[model samples]
Target: MARIAIIFLTFVCVFGGATFVKSIEEDFIRLPLTSLHSRSRRKADVVDPNAKKVNLWNDRNLQYGINITVGTPPQPFILHLDTGSADVWVPSVNGDCPYLCKAVNKYDSSKSSTYKEIPGKTFTLGYETGGLSGSVAEETISFAGLEIKNQVIGIGENQDTDLNSYPLDGIIGFPWSGATSQTDPKSTILGNLHKNGHIKKRFACLKLHQVNEQPGGELLLGGCDVEAEHWGRVYGNGYWEIPIDKVEAFGTDGNSLDSICGPGSSVPDCRATFDTGAAVIGGPSYLIDPIASKLGASKYDENINDYIVDCDDQTLGNLEFTFGKFKVVMTPGDYLSKDGNTCTLGFARLDDLSALLLGDPFLRKVTLLMNQEKDEAGLAKSNIDKPVARPT
Candidate 1:
C-alpha cells in the first residue's frame, strides 16, 4: 500500500502533561482485534457505549482486520484496517469477479434497503502489492457499536489475484481524505465520522500484539492511550514518515558491525514510513545489502528478491533504529522469520522509493499513535507483557 497520513482539523492537547478535554460523553472507542492464525482463550465483553469496543482479526501477522456491517439489516464482512490508504471497499456480488471474490463474503446491494448507487462514479485504488477498481455507492455502515449512515464505499468490480491469498472480505482505509476516490471529503468514512461528531479527536492508536499471542491487539479511535509512553514528533509530507538519526547493527559478541547510516557513514539523513498493511520492511538495495551482508546473509535469490539465511543461527544480534533521541531495538527473533529450516530477512529491497518502509516487523514493538489534526505521529513501546483482554 502507498504510505499516506490521516488528515483532519481539531484542537491539540498535551497528552502526558496537561488535562485532556473530553469532547463527548462517549469520547473514545477501544476496539479489540483477533489474529486469524491464533485462537484465544478469552471471552467477549459487553459493549459499553461509553467505552465502545469492536472485534478485529489479524491474518498471520501480515494484516489486521475488523468486522463491520453494511445496509439497513446489516450484512457483515471482515475488512482489513489499512493505515496506508483511504477509502472503504468491499467485494460486490454484482461485480464481474468470480474466482477470488467467491472465497470471501460479498456485498449484495439488492438485499440492502439503505443502499444507494452512485451512477457513473468509479473507485480505483493502487498499492505496492496489488490494486482494485470498482463502482461507488453509499450505505449505512456499522462497526463496534458505532453507526455511520450514508457512508460512501466502493463495491469492487475488479480485483488483483495477489489479494486472494489473504483471508479478508474488504478493506477499511484510514488515511487522509485526499487519498480517497471521493471528491467530497465528507463522503469518506473517517471524514463522515468527524463531520457527524462521532469522533472528537482526529487521531488513532494501534497496538499490535506479538505473533505468538492468542488474541491480537487494540485500535483506539479518537484518542491515545494515556498509559503508553510517548516518543518523538512525526515529520513528513502526505505520509506517516519520520526522521531516523541512525541505524546500527551488532553481532552476538556485542561488537558493532560497519555503520549503515548516520554520522561517519557514506549515507545520512534517513527517513522511514510506518505502514500497517505491509508485513516486512523495505528500503533501497544500497542500504539493505550492507546490513544483509553483515548478518552473513550473502546468498540473494534473484527470483524471490530476498536474501536467504539460516533459521538456526543462534549467534545473531540486535538491530537498533534511532529516531531522534529514542531508540527501538529489534532482536533476531523480531527481524527474521523462520519457515521450516529456511529463514529470510524481513527487510526487502525497494529501490523505487527514497525512504524506507517500516512495516509490521518494526510496528509490532510499538504502540503507534497518529494525530491527523497536527499532521504528526508518535510511538511507544507496546505493553504486550500484560495483554488487555478486550472484547473479541
Candidate 2:
C-alpha cells in the first residue's frame, strides 16, 4: 500500500454544538486529552489503580497525542497516537542532527539502565510529506499505568522538516504489528502487551472531541465504550479499514443528489481507514472531485492542491457515507475548514491510495471502537460528556 501524504492548514470553527456533559458509569482505562490551545488544565475525578489517566495533547486540531515514558528513570515524551501507521520512535539526544532533534524531547539511552541496543538493525518509514530513519533499540515503555518491558522502539538519527515542525516528540503508531518496519511483530507495543497478559482484551476506542472543547478526547484501551450507536466490521490486515457502501450528497433543497461509489457507480467496494494522525479526509480524485464540485468549491488550487470554498456558503448540506446498514453523515460544518478568511474543502486527493483515508474531519464527529484481535471497527455519534473510566 502506498503512503498518502497529508497536508492541512490550521483552522478554527465550532461544530457539534456545545460539548455533551454526561457521566460515564463504566470502568475502562481512560487517557484524558488536553487541547493545545487550552490554557487551563482539568483533572480527572475518577481514579483507579488499573486505570491510568495520561494527558493527551491535541496539537492545533491536527494531531492528538499522549505522553509515554521510555527507559529506566522514565524519560517522558509526548507522542502522536497515530492509527495510520505502525512504528514507535523518538529523536535521539546523541543523534548527529541537532536542529530538529533539539526542538522536542529526546531519548538518551546511556542515561537509562534498561536501554538495550539492537546493533545493525535500522528502520525507515516514508510519508507523502516527511519520513523518519532511525536505529532499532529496546527499552521499557510505561503508558497508561502499564509497563511494556523490552518494547522495541526506534531512535531517530535523521528527521524531516515536516516531522520536526510539529510540537510533538514522536509517534506511537496503532496499526497492526505486521505493518511496522522497525521490529518483529511480537516486539510492537500492542503485541507485547497482549502477549505478556498486560491487557485482557485487544481492543481500543478513540474519542476525539472538538478542537475548542476542553479535554480534547480520550483513548480507551481493552473495551469499547457504551456510547456508540452504530457498528461496522473492518477489512484489510494492516489498516483499520471499513467497507464504504456508497456516498451521497445533499443540497440546500434537503433532497439527496446522485450518489457515488456503489454497485453501479464508477467506483465500488470503496473502503476507508480512520487515521488519527491526519487532519483532513483524503480520497481518489474521482470521488473527491464530484463532492467538491457539488459543495461549490472552486477549481483545484495547484499551490495547496485542494479546492477552496466560500466560508459563508449556506447551500452546502451534508455528505453521507454508508457502510452496510450503518450510516455516517458529515454536515457542511464537518467538511469545510476555515483558515483565516479562506475556507477549503476538508477532502484531499490521493489518487494512488486503494482506500479512502478519513482523518480528523470525520473522526471528531464519532466515537470509533477498533478491535484488533477480531479485525473489526465500530462507530457511534460522538457523545463525549466526561472522561472515560476503566471498567470495574
Candidate 3:
C-alpha cells in the first residue's frame, strides 16, 4: 500500500504521553496502531542465509498492528491488514528460518482440524521492508464476529531481516486484488462475506489514531453507521478515491510556499488512493520537491532516497490540499516523524507512479469509509464522540 525508507539510528522519545484517543466521532471499530522500527539490514542484493534462495525486503519506522485469529478453535496472532497488497499469510512454525524470525508467530496445521495443505503450492511476498516465503494452505479466519471458511493463506517458511523485530505474526490482504496466484481467483475475505450474504454491504471504515497506548478506531466490516452523527458525507464509495484538485505548501509562517511546479498551480489533479497500509505519502518528484523545500526539508539522501527534515520545528503551517470540495490540511505532526532530534518528512517520491498516494499521514486526519460493492470512498473531518461498542 505504501513504500518504506531506510531508517537511521536515532534515540526515540514519546513526544505525547498516553491518552484515550478518539477517531472521527466513534463511527467505526477501534483498533490500535503502534510506531515500529526495524534494527535490520537494508540490502537485498546478498542472499540471506535465513531466507531460502529468495529475494529479501528492507526498511524502518513503520506501523505495527494488533492480533488476529485463525484456525478452527481460533488461534490469535498479530497480522497487518494491508489494503495495498492482498494475500493472508503467517510465518511457519516448521520453518528453519533465522533468529530474526524467532519471535514471529507460526501456524501449526496439525493443531487445527480445519487446516488443509494445498500441496505443491508455494507463496512468496516481497515488500520494501522485506520478503516472506512459504506455501499455500486453507484455513478458517475470523474478524470482528464474522467468519470465512476454507480461506486461502500463505504460511511463511522463510523471512528476511526487514521483517525481523516486527510486532506482527502475519498479514491479511483486504483489497480487491486479493489473490496470491492464478490457481485461486476469489474476492478478499471481506468481499466473500458480502458475496455470500453474510454482510449487508461490502464496506469498511478505518480511523487510525495518533501515537497512543490505547487508541480508538476499528475496521467496520459491514460499513459505517450512517446513522452516526460523525459519518461524513459520502463522496466516492468504491475505494476511498479522491481527485487531487490542487497542492499547496505553507512555510513556518503560514505564507504560500514555492515549489518546482510553481506557486499554487494545479499539478494535473491526479487520482489519489487513501490507504491505511501505507505509512508515507507518495507522488511524483515534481509535485513533492516544492513541498519539501517550503518545509525546509533536507535534500535527498542516497542512503534512503528520501528527504529527512528537522523534527523539532513547529512553526510550520499545514500542508493543504483541495479534495473535491473538501480542504484537507496536514499539520507538522501529521507529516513529520519526530523521534528525538531525528526528524524525517512523511513524503516519498515515486516518479513512476501516476497516482498520488494519500497514506496514513493524510488518513490520520480524516475518516475513510469504503464501500467495495459500489467501488467508492468517503472522506470527512474526524469528530470526537462518546465511546461505541466494537463489532465482535
Candidate 4:
C-alpha cells in the first residue's frame, strides 16, 4: 500500500437521476457500481463540460474521508455521504469500475500492510452511477486526531464488479466527509469506535458545494471551529437518520416561500440520510416540487431533478429545518453561492417530491453531525463550531 498520510475525510459525488430533486421519488440503484461503466446513465448524472464546476468530476461523492491505520499502513479514501443509498465501500485491486475509477498506480505495500479480514461478512455499496462491493474485514481507520480500529471494512471482488483497470484502492462511503477520503471504511471505523466505547462520541460533519454551481467551499468533521475537550465535544454525525422538521422555499422575504405544512407532522416523512455520496439534496414527491408549485415558486424541468437556475434573484430565500433544539435557518445566499460565471445558483426538485433528501446545497449551510451508534445527529449552524468561508 502506498504511504498515505493520516486519514482525512473529504467528499465528492453528484446528484443524478430524478430522485435527486427534493421530494421526488424515482428508482435509484442503491448498490455501488459493479464497475465505473455503470455511470448511472440518467438525466441528472451527466455534467456539462462547459458548465460552472469546470472540474467534470466535481460531484460530492468524490470528496470524503480521512486517513486510517490498517496495521501500520496508511490508507486514504473519500466517502460518498449519500442519503439516497446505503452500504460502504473501498478501492480494491479487482476490476470493472471504469466510469468512476481513478488509478493510483501501484500501492507500495512494503512499509506495513496491517489489515484483518472478517471471514464471512460481505459488504455491497451501489448507486445509479457505480459501486464498490467487497467482503467485510477489520482494520484500523484513523482521522486527523482520532482513530478507530477492528471495524468491518469492504474488500471488492475482482470477478464480481468492474473496477476500472486503475480504480481508487480507497473507499466509497455514506457517512459525512469533512476528514479525508483516503481512508477505508471511514464511517464504520468512526461508528465502531463510538459503539465499542473506544471513544465517548464520534462525529461526521460536511460542507458541500451545490450540484450546479462551482467555486464554493468545504465541510468539516470533529467540530472544526469548536474546540473539543475530550474529542467528544467535537460534534459530528458519523451516521444519522433525521426527520424533516420543516421545508420551506423562501421568497425574497427570507421566509417560507412555499407552504409545505399540511403534511400532519412539521417535517417530511422519510429516513433523511446525511450522505456524502449525493451532490444535490433529494426527497420524495408531495414534499418537494408539489409544495413549490403550491407556493408559486420557480422550478425548472431541465429534464432532470437537479437543475441550474439563472438565479440572479440572489436570495434563494430561507429554508429552515429543525433537529432537536436546533432550528437551522438556510438562507438563499447559501445556495446562491457565488460560483463560476453562472447566471444563477443551482437548485432542483425531485420528480416525486414526497420524501425529503438534503444534499450538499443544504449541508453546506448547516452543521450536520452523525451518530451511527445512536442513529442520531447534532444539527448546528454550519458556522456553529466552524468558520464559514465565503466563495471567492
Strongest candidate by lDDT: 2
Each prediction's whole-model lDDT (CA): 0.63, 0.66, 0.55, 0.39
Winner on TM-score (1 vs 4): 1
lDDT of 1 by residue, 297-369 (tens): 7787754456777776667666788776557877776777655566877677778767777887788887777
RMSD of each: 11.3, 9.4, 12.6, 14.9
TM-score quality measure for candidate 3: 0.74
Of candidates 4 and 1, the better by lDDT: 1
**C-alpha positional error of residue 355 in candidate 3 after TM-score superposition, expressed in Å:** 2.0
Measured on C-alpha atoms, candidate 1 has an lDDT of 0.63
Residue-wise lDDT of candidate 2 within 233-313, one digit each (tens)?
A: 666557778777788766666585757677777786788788886788888888888777665565687676678777776
In lDDT terms, how accurate is model 4?
A: 0.39
C-alpha TM-score for every candidate:
0.79, 0.82, 0.74, 0.57
Q: Ten-residue segment with the worst summed lDDT in candidate 4?
A: 1-10
Of 1 and 3, the candidate ranking higher by lDDT: 1
How do the candidates rank by TM-score, highest first?
2, 1, 3, 4
Model 4, position 104, has a per-residue lDDT of 42
Q: Give one clash count per candidate, in the order shown.
A: 2, 7, 19, 114
**Clash count (model 3, backbone only):** 19
Superposition error at 348 for model 3 (Å): 1.9
